[model samples]
Target chain A: MSGDIVIEAKGLTKTYGQAVAVDHISFTVGRGEIFGLLGPNGAGKTTTILMLLGLTDISGGQVSVLGFNPAREPLSVKRRVGYLPDTVGFYDQLTAADNLRYTARLIGFRLAEREKRIGEALDRVGLSEFAEHRVGTFSRGMRQRLGLAEILMKGAQIAILDEPTSGLDPHATAELLTIIRRFKTEGVSVLLSSHLLERVQSVCDRVALFSAGRIALMGSVSDLGREVLGSGYVVDIEAEGSGLGERLALVPGVNRVEQTGIGKLRLHADRDVRPEAAAEVVAQHGRLKFLGVQEPSLEAIYTHYFAARPDGTLKEGARHAA
Target chain B: MRREGSAFNGLGVVMLKELADHLTSIRFIILEIIVMLIAVGTVYVATQQIKDTVAQDPFLFLKFFTTSRAPLPSFIFWLSLLVPVMAIGLAFDSVNGEYNRRTLSRILSQPIYRDALLFGKFLAGLMTLAIALLVLWLLVIGLGLLFIGIPPGGEEVARAFVFLLVTLIYAGVWLALGLLFSIVFRSAATAALATLGLWLFFYVIWPVLAGEISQIIVPPDPRYMALGLQTPGTVVLEQFLARLSPSTLFGEIVVAILDPTTRALGPIYLSQLQGAVLGAPLPLGASVLIAWPQIVGLIATSIILFVIGYVVFQRQEVRA
Candidate 1:
């Protein structure tokens, strides 16, 4: 992806009376990048999305989407940006084609062009067969897909999706993520918010971890794992041997070793100790079952950051990333 | 911050969608059927009564709307009462229903401004009411021509046209009221109930309360009090207070336009009737002049209520 900023928010803040929904936070989304906003419920993710769409007024700071101020030029901004809200409601009484037609008209598409675009959008979202069916009869997954079709029909340059997979099963979630990736392939800048760390990690190029209306950590997933977990590699060894932890701890470059199971031992080392450790295991005459390095999962990094404080704030040493 | 150019960019699309929905919905169809049946039945009974009592009357065609049979009210009375019912039915759930279904934010996210949605809904509701009223008017006139065996005079037709226009304006008042309540109340059921309650109060209970309040404010003269003879001041005050309700204003206009012999809507001095022939019909323009304030009153109330709905809707946050 080219390094061109499509969305920029500087010191963005939102306040409802005395309650600060979003504190001063700044971020930029580059074109053709999938940026995730990771936060738990009430962590100001949806509030931030609304502020970016100009659906809600910003209490302070500024937001620019595609070089237009959302608050001042919302029509101009809305014309180029598509938003799929958390609920993703449609006119249930109308057929899918009729619902899309209403939006097409709102976007000022000409009569001859509207039909062609609607057909293409339906086909893109795999909803062409259900075009004539009433939306009331549609399942949740079908509705979500139709919402994506609406965004495609608008020919939007940016899409802001708020919890696009909140209520979906694993199958539907995977399907939606695939479609979202397709959007990236089409060069559309996407900003998706979710509390599902694994899903976000699987799809996002970069993420900003939100904690109590503040970004506690922001970086690529691998970088964040390294930053939080430190420069250490976890090696898991399953061998039918006695005194494995004692023998593994004496190896060079090994920081700590612990027996995790009846015949399993995990060793933490500053570097790859697999080669020497294998030799030591063979000399000790232990039968090795399995030996591999375990990369830190996003779950581990998320737990590390959240477990550091009751309020989900990062500790002083990790605050530099914020 | 007003945007340049038209604030009505997407108005036609929104309006067309709403109109199509209203026309095809069962609610509107049921209302139209009920009203049409009652109107045709009332006119049929009135035609029979007119044939028996005034077969040779010069202005017999006017009786189709103004004549009251033994057990049935006149056509105008049914219209004044049921037209508001239809208007309220169409609009009571308009704004809140969108919120309940969670479509408000989705629709607002489009390129249009908030002004288009509310304005478009109002216009759509008004247009539906207009179409229904026009059809009913034609049906009544057709029935009159068939049963009465004579076409109405030019003056009678003109007066009837004015009456229909005024009735539409009256319906617009209730449409605006329902839309305002829909914006104020979140639940569709609550908005519908509130609209019906207000309709009941204005149509049935307000006139009695106005009468009592007028009596307290301007009691009858002591000499005529025992005979239930109200003073002119009491009568005028009561009339003024009753006209505050749109139903009362509509009733006054109906009486003035449908029955051209109505010389005045308020207390008429005997001197004002000097040299006037009894039972003579007033000119069509004169009848309109007499009901001018009631017409203006209906139109102004509709505008004021619509403005309230517009302001509330524009200020509302899109998040459901």
Candidate 2:
């Protein structure tokens, strides 16, 4: 990812009568970066994406895709940004290629270029073999892949995917993540929204955690985990000795220590205190049974952040909007 | 808010794509078959009946569309009903089908505005109806030629062509209604049922309701009832209420266009008809002039319905 920004939103808002679907929120996606919008089902992730795509009106604030304002210059923004809506649908009666042809025509691609682009896109998504098959016969995973192929066919500078891997199996999720990674390598900035945190965590360079029309947190997963989980590293130590937690707390860079069980101690530290904590345990005449530094997982951060909030309940009407 | 590009940027592509879908759809084929069978039956009956009375009728081609040979009404009578059904069939699922398929947002996310999608689908629906109606129109003309063994005068052909155009506009009104219902109702079945129900109310129930309403509005005069003569105000009120339906307007237009001897649509005094020949065919222009208000009424209804659908669609959220 470069220092150049591809998407920027400031004080973005969407309100429907008395209900606020997406309250004032701000975020940016840099070139060639993968930005995830992670939240629960009714958390306004989809509404924000729609606003950026200019599919819905932005009630307040500004959003720019590349350099053009999505609201006022949607054609220019849309021409360069490809969007895969939630459960992205295709014409069931049309063959996969025929469906792409319709999109290609809409994109104003000429005949020869359209066919070439469609073939290349299908091949890249591993849907080349099914190009002649009607989309109705495709499985859920294949439909998602076809949606990616549409983005690929557009040769868009930025791909905005909404719940791209919602219903995919583990194997399909891995395959889709690989394809998304390809977009990053190709220097196409990607902003994908998904509720599957851990599954998409590996690919996102940064994410905005949405809750009830507002972004509660935004940053890289590890950075968020550090801020939310209150530690850069979690060192767990297991040994048969009394006051093992006290000994680990004395280790350099270790901030807090908690005795989890009869022979277990967990340490929250600034660095990997595993080696030092292990040595400290042995010096205390304790047999070191286990010592491992736990990498902060996105699920842990998300769960921890929500659990700590006093009023994190999602609004009912936001569910209908998103 | 000034948009960067033309709102109609992708209109042709969307229209052609939707047009292809409409033409190849199984539902469209089934509708065409039923309309064809009805057209053939009516024209065959009309041709059979016209054979004996073919001696003096100047507009023999027009007779094929209006002549009833027992058990079956004239081609126009069947057409007035068939046009709406075919129109409703083509459009009842147009917008909602996209919602059900979950394809509306994906299509709108393309480099085009919502204007293109809505108007394109509408134009495509009208074009689909036009294709079928044109084919049916030519078939009747061809059958009239084959059975009557006489070429229709230019005036007869022109008047029949005007009838064809008026019927197309009438179809547009129902198409717009169906499209509106499709947008207003999410379920395709509900859209179809609502549109068909409205059509039934207008075609079958509304006229009867109008008669009752008009009588109430202009109470029956005992003196006129005893003489078996209707009160003037009651008849005018009844016709006015019935004309509110597109069906009545379509029927009136077809009547004026096909039968040129009909001089006036509304009530005319005896003094007004004294100078006119009893059975002389009016010029094509005169016939069109007579049906002009009804034709304009049909077009206006379609535009109003389409505008309503367009406004609703514009404000509607693009997500399923």
- Pick the TM-score winner: 2
Cα lDDT of model 1 by residue, B69-107, tens digit: 878898888888899999999999999999988888888
Predictions in order: lDDT: 0.88, 0.91
lDDT digits (tens) for residues B1-320 of candidate 2: 67788889899999999999999999899989988898888888988888876768778888989999788898888888888999999999999999989989898889999889989999999999999999999998887788778888898888888888888999999999999999999999999999999999999999999999999999988898999988889999999999999999988888899998989987887898888998898898888899899999999999999999999999898886
Predicted candidate 1 versus true structure: per-residue lDDT over A1-322, tens digit per residue: 4779999999999887767778998999999999999988878898899889888888999889999888888889888998998878889999999999999998899998999999999999899999999999998988888999999999999988988888898988888899999999999999999988787688898899887787888888877888898857888898877777788899999999987888899999988899978987887889998899876677888888778665555432243244
List the candidates' TM-scores in order: 0.91, 0.93
In model 2, the clashing pairs are: none
DockQ of each: 0.59, 0.73
Worst 10 residues of 1 chain A by lDDT: A313-322
Candidate 2: segments with Cα more than 4 A from true spot? A235-251, A254-268, A273-292, A314-322
True contacts kept of each: 0.63, 0.81
Clashing pairs in 1: none
The per-prediction tally of clashing pairs is 0, 0
